[model samples]
Structure formats: structure tokens, C-alpha cells
Target: MARIMSGVQPTGNLHIGNYLGALVNWVRLQDQYEAYFSIVDLHALTGRPEPAALRHAVREVAIGVLASGVDPERATVFVQSHVPQHTELAWVLTCLTPLGDLNRMTQFKDKSQHQPDNINTGLFTYPVLQTADIVLYRADRVPVGEDQEQHLELARETVRRFNHVYGETFPEPQVVKSSAPRVMGLDGESKMSKSRNNEIGLFETADETMLKLRGAKTDPARLRKTDKGTPEVCNIYSYHGFFTGEVQRAAIATGCRSAQLGCVDCKKLLAQNLEVVKGPIRERAAVLREQPRRLEEILAAGAHRARAEAEKTMVLVRERVGLGAPRS
Candidate 1:
């Protein structure tokens, strides 16, 4: 099986956007590929999160990943910092990466604008580290959202540059696009993110989820209960496309267009469908949280597996780049 690698940052609680956009796909892909999924704690550092909060977030994100059905036995699941070779390889790749490429990255520009006071080198070179994260595993494919397409392209370019200079040391990883590539937040104007406070947490109780849904933005054209709504323009309807069945989604769409389903009723239906998926995940996460030792063991085992693979790649990289002592 071709190897695929992907990761989630331990920045905040995993949300429904995460579930539909990434984690759900990760669960399905595990059986078809040699999968490596990491809680990328190193990447999370750019946000300058509090030390204790970061540690707590990492554990919580691990629970979220495991509870979402990413089996440890099927996929190598580890913390990114646990294997030092990621940053080690990142430095090597960073040297090969062009400054112009980093400058052109829209994400870097957006992030810089978001945190102008803290525009550090790490923020600028984020893509280079991401390139290292994938190629360090010699991952043949990477599951990426629409937002990361540019970064993946850069990864491919960096790999090609390394190959041109040092021979074919790594494969150019291909993209495995998610089914729901860009899940909009409840605001319906931007991507779902914890920073925006527009996300519904994956582990939230049914009541909590429903409360958020109640205030979610729908079609602006929808003026009242009897007004016909456009499901295509409604973020809630987009959500139904992911969580709700085809038959029900079609019914919902018809109901929406016909003014039969009010926004409140529509949101309630979405809340119910969401619970069908998240309820089990939340329960599983609770069990994992109660057993912190078990979570550590899984992460440790995964790191051991990941480190072994990373070392193999580094050995070749060292030899190719003439980094280590001369071979006798």
C-alpha cells in the first residue's frame, strides 16, 4: 500500500469542521494506505500557546483523534515533537526552499496580518516545516484541505529541488483531497475555526451543539418562516450534505425551497444528525481521557514506529547530503 501522512495541530478542541473535513477521511483512508497521523504539537507552537494549555490541548486532541476512529493498530499515531527528526529534516529542507516561495504563501501573509506584532520566522517558514513533516516519512500522499493546497504544492517543489541537487532521495507526495475540503463555520462567512469562536466542538454535548446551531447563519434571503430559502446558499444545508443522508438531504433541500422547513426546524434536524456521529466519539473520548496512561502508551508506540521510519530516511538524506562522517 502507498504510504500517506497527515496531521492535525493541537491548537484547540476538535470541531465538527475537523470531523467532516479531515478526521472522517482519515478513518476511511487508514485501511487503504500505510497511514501516519500525528498530533503536530510543534506546528502549534507558532500560536505561542500557554505551556500547560498546550499540553492539555495535545492530550485532548489525541483523544479526539482516537475517538474519531483513527485506529492505532491501523495507522501510526504519534505526537510530532516526539520524533526529533521532523525538525532536523525541516532545517535541511528549509535551506533548499526558496525565500520567494515562502513569501508567496497566502497563509503566511494571512497569518502575518492576523498577528502583525508576532510575525516571526517560524510563521514565514511554516510551509517548509510542513514539507519536512511529509517527506521525512517519505509519504507518497498527503490528505490536504483546500487551504493547504499551496503548501502541498511547495512540498512537491521542494522535493523536486532536493532530487535535482541530491538525486532521487524522496518521492513527490500527491494530494488526497478531503470530500468536504472547506467546511464553513456557523458564521457562514469564513472557515470554521476555534479562534473565530464559530465552531461547534466535536466533543460538545448534544444540548451544547444544538445551542450553537440555533444561532447559526442561514440564507440571508430567508426573512421569515414562510419565506422560501436557498439551501445552496445556507451553511447549515452545506453541513447537511456531509452529515445527513442523501434522501433526507434532498427532502431538507426541498423543504427549504418550499418554505416548509423553518430555519429552527432545519437546525434542529442538523443537531440530531450531528449527534448520531459525535455522540459515540464524545463517549469514546471520555473513556480515553479517563485512561491517560493508555493514551501515552499508544503515542509512545506510534512514536517508536515513526522514529524508525524517519531514521531510515535521514540515513539516506545524511549520506546524500554528505552530512555524517565519511563512510570507511
Candidate 2:
């Protein structure tokens, strides 16, 4: 089976945007690929989360991934920091990455602008670490959202550069595009992000999810309950495209355009459907939370498996780059 490498940041409050956009899709790919799903705590460090919060975030993300349908038995689900090779290889790749290349990364620019006061080297060289994460496992494919397509392109570029210099040790990774790629946030303006504070967490209670949905922004044109709103322009309807079946989505679209459904009632319907889909996952996550040792055991075993693969690649990498003991 082809190997796939993918990860989500330990952002603590994971939302439906994560589920409909990536996690659910990851669940479907496990049987088809040798999936390595990671809770990338290291990646989350750019934001400078407190130690206690970071630990909690890591556990929360792991539980969320497990509860959302990523089978630990099928996929090697591990914590990124647990595998030391990721940072080691990132340093090697960082030396090869050009300032110009990193400068052009849109995410780097956006993040810097967002946190100018604390913009550090880690934020600048983030893509290099991401490249290391994928190439360390020699992943054949990487499941990514549209925002990360540029980073994936950069990863492929790094692969080509490494191969040119070291005689083709790593294969260029491919992108496995998500079916529902860019999930808009409750604000209906930007992508659902923890930093943006526009997310409705996947593991939040049904009541909490409903509370968030009730306040979610919809088509501005629909000022009154009787105003005809275009579903194509409505973020709520886009959500329906993900959570609601085709027939229901059609009804929603028709209702919105014809002014048959009030935004309040429409939002209620979405909340009901969203809860139906995500409520069980939240329950499962609750159970997983109670068993902290079980999560630890899972991470430990996953790290062992991941390290075995990583060490093999690193051994070859060391020989190629003359880092480790010289081969006989």
C-alpha cells in the first residue's frame, strides 16, 4: 500500500471545519493507504502555547482524531514531537531552503503579519519542518487542504533539491485533495481557525455547537425572514452541502432562495443535523478522555512504529550526507 503522511496541529478546540474538511476524509483513506496521522504539537509551538495548555491540546487532538474515525489499528497515529527525527531532518532541510523560498510562502507572510511582535525563525522556517515531516517517512501522498497546497508544492521542491544533491533518496510526495477542502468559519469570511475564534469545535457538546451555529453569519442580503437569500452565497448552505444529504441540501437551497425558510429556523435545522453527525464523535472522545493511560499507550506504540520507519530513512540519509559513522 502507498504510504500517506498527514497531521493536524494540536489547536485544542478542534471544530466541525476540521471534521468535514480533513479528519473525516482521513478516516476513509486508512484502508487504502499506510496512513501516518500525527498530532503535530511541534507545529503548534509557533503560537507559543503555555506548557500545560500544549499538553492538553495534544491530548485533545489525539482523542478527537481517534473519535472522528481514524482507526489507530489501521493508521499509525502518533505525536510529532515523540519522533525526534522530524526536528533532526528539519534542520538538514532548513540549510538547503533558500530565504527567498521561505519569504514567498503566503502563510509565513500572513502569520508574520498576525504576530509581528513575536515573529521568530520557527515561523519563517515552518515549511521546511513540514517538508521534513513528509519526506522523513518517504510518504507517497499527503492529504492537504487548499491552504496547504503551496506548502506541499514547496515540499515537492525540497524533494527534488534533495534528490539532485544526494542522488534520489526520497520520492516526490503527491497531494490527496480533500473532497470538501476549504470549510469556511462561522464568520463566513475566513477559514475555520482557532486563532480566528470563528470555529465550532467538533467535540463541543451538542448544545454548545447549536449555540455557535445560532450566531453564525449567513447571507447578509437576507435581512428579514421573508427576504430571498441566495444559498450559493450563504455559508450555512455550504455547510449543508457537507452535513446535509443532497435532497435536504436542495430543500435548503430552494427554501433560502424562495424566502420559505427563516435564517433562525434554517440555522436550527443545520444545528440538528450537525449534532446528529458529530454528537457520537464527541461522546467517544469523552470516553477516550477518561482513559488517559490508553491514549498514552497508543502514542507510545505509534511512536515506536513511526521511529522504526524514520530511523531507516535517516540511516540512509546520514550515509548519503556523511553525517553518521562512515559505512564500511
> Which ranges in model 1 have alpha carbons more than 4 Å from their true place?
325-328
Cand. 1 Cα-lDDT: 0.93
RMSD of every candidate to native, in Å, equals 1.7, 1.7
Question: Compared with the true structure, what per-residue lDDT tens digits does model 1 show for residues 25-92?
Answer: 99999999999998999998998899999999999999999999999999999999999999989999
Give the TM-score of each candidate: 0.98, 0.97
Q: With candidate 2 superimposed using the best TM-score fit, by how many Å does residue 37's alpha carbon deviate from the native?
A: 0.8
The weakest ten consecutive residues by lDDT in model 2 span 319-328
Clashes of 1: 0
Model 2 stretches with alpha carbons more than 4 Å out: 325-328
What is the alpha-carbon lDDT for the whole of candidate 2? 0.90
Error of 1 at 303 (Å): 0.4
**Model 1: lDDT of residue 148:** 98
Measured by C-alpha RMSD in angstroms, how accurate is candidate 2?
1.7
Query: Model 2, range 216-286, lDDT digits (tens) per residue?
Result: 88998989998999999889888888888889888888898899999988888888888888889989999
